[model samples]
Target: MRKTTFLIPILVIAAVIGLSSMFIVDERERALVLQFGRVVAVKEEPGLAFKIPLIQEVVRYDDRILSIDVQPLEVTPLDDRRLVVDAFSRYRITDVEQFRQAVGVGGIRTAEDRLDSILRAETREVLGSVSSKDILSSDRAALMLRIRNAAIAQARALGVEVIDVRLKATDLPTQNLEATFDRMRAEREREATDERARGNEAAQRVRAQADRTVVELVSDAKREAEIIRGEADAERNMIFAEAYGADPEFFEFYRSLTAYGRAIQGGNSSMVLSPDSDFFNYLKSPNGAGQ
Candidate 1:
C-alpha cells in the first residue's frame, strides 16, 4: 500500500512535467521558446513544440494578419490647412524570433504600440507633403500607398510587415469647421455679387442703348413732321397764287370773305368801319367792286 501511494504521487508529478514540456501551436500562431526571458527557439510551423519543463517557457504570437486602429491626429498640409485624420493598418509578424526579441514580455501589445507610432509618423509625413485637396480627393489612394510603403520601411525594425495603411476619415477640426464654412459662404457670396454686378452692368448698357434709340426715333419723327408741314404750306400758297392768276375779282372776293369770317366768328363780336371802306366792298358788290 505504501509503495502504491508513492508510485501514484510520482506518476502525477511526471504527468505534470510531461504536459509542461510540450505545447500545441495552432496554424494561426507562432511559438517562441524562451529561457530566462531570452528567446532560444522559434517554432513557426503549426504542430507540437517542446520546451524544458519549468526551465523554459513558450510564448505564442498570432501568425495571421493583424490590425491596429491608430489614434486620430492633426496634420498640416502644404497649403497650411490643418486637418484631423483617423487611420488604420494591417500588419503581420513575419519573423517571430525578431518580434520576440523586439517586444519581449509585452508581446503583441507592445508591437502594436510601436506599429501605431510608425503609421502615425508616416501618415503625417506623407500627408504633410501634399495639399488638403489631394488628401480629400480620389488621389488619396496613391497617398495611402505611399503611407504604407513608408510604414513598411520603418516597421522592419519591429519585425513587422505593414500590409496596408488607410485613412478612415480626414476632416477639418471642430473649431476650424465653422471657419471653413464661413469662408465658403463668403466665396459664394462674392461670386453672387460679381454675377449680379455683371447683370446690372449689362442691364445698364441695354437701358442706355434703348434710351438712345428712343431719342433718335423721336428726333427723326419731329424732323419728318416739320418737312411735311413745310411742304403742305408751300402747296397751299401755290394753289392760292393759281387762283389769283385765273380770276382777279373772284380771288379778291374770296380773300375779303375769309377776312370777314375771321373778324366776325362769334355772335358777340363788334366792329366799326367806314361804309365805303374796302372792307365793305364784298357786301356792297358781289364782284368786290363798289358798283
Candidate 2:
C-alpha cells in the first residue's frame, strides 16, 4: 500500500509537469517560442507545440488581417479652404521575427501610430499641393492610390503589409460650408436674373419686329386697295367720255335725264320746280328735241 501511494503521487506530479510543457496552437494563432523572454523561434503554423517547462515560454500572435482607424485630420487645399478628413488603413503581418522585434507582440497599435503619421504627412502634402476642385473631383482617386502606394513602401520595413488606405469622409468646416453655400446661391440667383433679362430683351425684339411687319403688310394692302379703286374710277370715266364723244345728242339727253334723277333724289328736302321746264324735254318724246 505504501508503494502504491508513492507511485500515484509521482504519476500525478509527472502529469502536471507534462501539462506545463505541452501547449496547443490553434490554426488561427501563431506561436512564438521565447527563451528567457527573448524570441528564439516563431511558429506560424497550427497544431501542438512543446517548450521547456519554466525555462522557455511561448507567446502567441494573431496572423489575421487587422484594421487601423486613424483620427480625423484638418487639411488645407491650394485654395486655402480648410477641410476635415477622416481616414483608415488595413494591414497584416508578413514577417513575424521582424514584427516582434519592431512592434513587440502588440497587435496593431504600433502599426497604427506609424501609419497615422505617414497618413497625416502625406495627406498634408497631397492636399496642400492640390487645388480644391482637384481634390474634390479629378484627383481624389489618384490621390488615394498614391497614398496607398506610399504607405505600403513605408510600412514594409516594419514587417507589415499595407493592404489599403482609404479616406472615410471629407467635409468642409461648418462655417466655411455655410459661406460657400451662400456664395453659390448668390451666383445661381445672378445667373437666373441675367437669363430673365436676356429673355425679356429677346421677347421685346421679337414683338417690335412683328409689329413692324404687321405695319408693312397693312400699308401694302392699303396701297393695293387704292390702286384698284383708282383703276375702277378711271375705267368708269373713260367709258362715260367715250360715249359722250361717240354721239353728242344721245349722250346729252342721257346726261340731262341723269341730272333730273339726281335733282329729285337729293334727299326728301322741299324743292320747287317750274312747269314746262327744259328738264322735261327728254320725257316729251324720243325724237321731240325742238319741243
Candidate 3:
C-alpha cells in the first residue's frame, strides 16, 4: 500500500512537468520561448512548441491586425483654420522577434503607446500643410495616405507594420462654429434689411408717380369741361342775337309778353297799368303788333 501511494504521487508530478514543458502556438498567436528571462526561440507556426520545464517560459503575442483609436486633437491648418480631429490606426506586429526585443515585457500596451505618438506626429506634419477645405474634401484620402506612409516609416522601429491611418472626424471647434453661425445670421439680417429698404424706396417712388398722374388727370378733365361750357353759352347767345335781328317788332312783342307773364304770375296780383299800355298790347291784338 505504501509503494502504490508513493508511485501515484510520482506519476502526478511527472504529468505536471510534461505539461509545463510543452506550449501551444495557435494560428492567431506567435510565441517567444524565453529561458531565464532571455528570449531563446520564436515559434510562429501553429501547433505544439517545446521549452525546458521550470527554466523556460512562453510569451505569446497576437498576430492579427490591431486597431487603436487615439484621442481627439486640435490642429491648425495652413489657412489658419482650427479643427478638432479624431483618428485611428490599423497595424500588426510583423516581426515578433523584433517586437519582443523592442517592447520587452511591456507587450501590446507599450506598442500601442508608441504607435499613438507616431501617428499623432505624422498626422500633424501632413495635415499642417493642407487647408481645412482640403481636409474636409475628397483630397482627404490623399492626406490620410501621406500620414499612413510617414507613420509606417517611423513605427518600423517598433517592428510594427502600419496598414492604414485614417481620420475618423474633422470638424470645426465648437466655439468657432457657434461664432460662424452668428456671423452668418448677422449677414443675412443685414441683407434682408437692405432689401426691405430698397423695396420701400421703390414703393415710395411708384406711389408719388401715381398721385401726380391722378392730379394731372383731374386738372385736364376740369379744363376740358369749362371749355365746352363756354362754347355752348356763346352759341346760345349768338342764336338769340340772330333771332332778334330777323324781326325787331316781334322780338319786342315777345319781350313784352314775357314781362306780362312775370307780373301776373301770382293769382292775387294787382297791377295799376293803363288798359292802353304796351304791356297789354299782346292780349289786345291777335297779331303781336303793338299800338
Candidate 4:
C-alpha cells in the first residue's frame, strides 16, 4: 500500500511538470520564452513550444493586426484655420525580439505611447504645410499617405509595422465656425450686389441705345420731309415758268386772278382800292387791253 501511494503522487507531479514544460501557441499569437526575466527565444510560428518548468516563462502577444484609437486634437493648417481631427491607426508587431528589448516588462502599453506620438507628429507636420481647403479636398488622401510613410519610418525602432493611418472625421473648431460662416455670407452678398449693379448698367446702356435710335429716326424723317418739300417747290416753279413762257399775257392774267383770290382767301376779308387800279383792268376788259 505504501508503494502504490508513493507512485500515485509521483505520477501526478510528473503530469503537472510535463504540462508546464510545453505550451501550445495559437496561430493568432506569438510567444516569447524568458529565463530569469530575460528573453531567451521568440516563437512567432504557431504550434507546441517547449520550456523548462518553474525556470522558464512564455509571454504571449497578439500577432494579428491591432488598432489604436487616437484622441481628437486640433491642428492648424497653412491657411491659419484650425480643425479638430479624430483619427486611428492600424499596426502589427513585425519584430518581436526588438519589441521585447524596447518595451521590457512594460508590454504593449509602453509601445503604444511611442507609436501614437510618432503618428501625431507626422500628421501635424503634413497638415501644417497645407491649407484648410486642401485638407478638406481630395488631396487629403495624398497627405495621409505622407503621414503614414513618415510614421512608418519613425516607428521602425518600436518594432512595429504601421499599416495605415486614417482620419475618421475632421471639422472646423466650434469657435471658428461662426466667423467662417459670416464671412461666407458677406462674400455672397457682395457678389450678388455686384451682379445687380452690372445688370442695371447693362440695362441703362440698352435704353440709351434705343433712345438714340428713336432720335435718329425722327431727325431722318424730318430731313426727308424738308427735301421732298424743296423738290416740290422747285418743280412747281418750273411748271409755272414754262406755262408763262408759252403764253405771257394769259399767265399775267392768271397770276392777277391768283393774287386777287389770295387777297380774299379769309372767310371774313375786305379790301379798298382805287377804281382806276390796275387790278380793275382784268375786270374792265377780258382781253387785258386796258393796261
TM-score of candidate 2 on Cα atoms, chains taken together:
0.71
Give each model's whole-structure lDDT. 0.91, 0.83, 0.90, 0.90
Indicate the residue-level lDDT of 213 in model 2: 100
Q: What does each candidate score in C-alpha RMSD?
A: 2.8, 5.4, 6.5, 4.0
Candidate 3 regions with alpha-carbon error over 4 angstroms:
1-9, 174-178, 205-291
Better of 1 and 4 by TM-score: 1
Best by TM-score: 1
What ranking of all candidate models by TM-score puts the best one first?
1, 4, 3, 2
Per residue, candidate 1 scores C-alpha lDDT tens digits across 1-291 of: 999989999999999999999999999998888899888998888888889998998888898999899999999999999999999999999988888778878988999888888889999999999999999998789999999998887798888999998899998999999999999999999999999999999999999999999999999999999999999999999999999999987898789889988998878889899899989876887544544
User: Ranking by lDDT, best first?
Assistant: 1, 4, 3, 2
Candidate that scores best on lDDT: 1
The local distance difference test score of model 1 is: 0.91
lDDT tens readout by residue for model 2, 15-53: 988999999888876888889769887888788888888
Local lDDT at 73 for model 3: 83
Range of the 10 consecutive residues with the lowest summed lDDT in candidate 1: 282-291
Model 3 vs. true fold: TM:
0.72
Per-candidate clashes, comma-separated? 0, 0, 0, 0
Per-residue lDDT value at 84 in model 1: 99
Residue lDDT tens for model 4, 3-58: 99999999999999999999999999898999998989989888999999999999
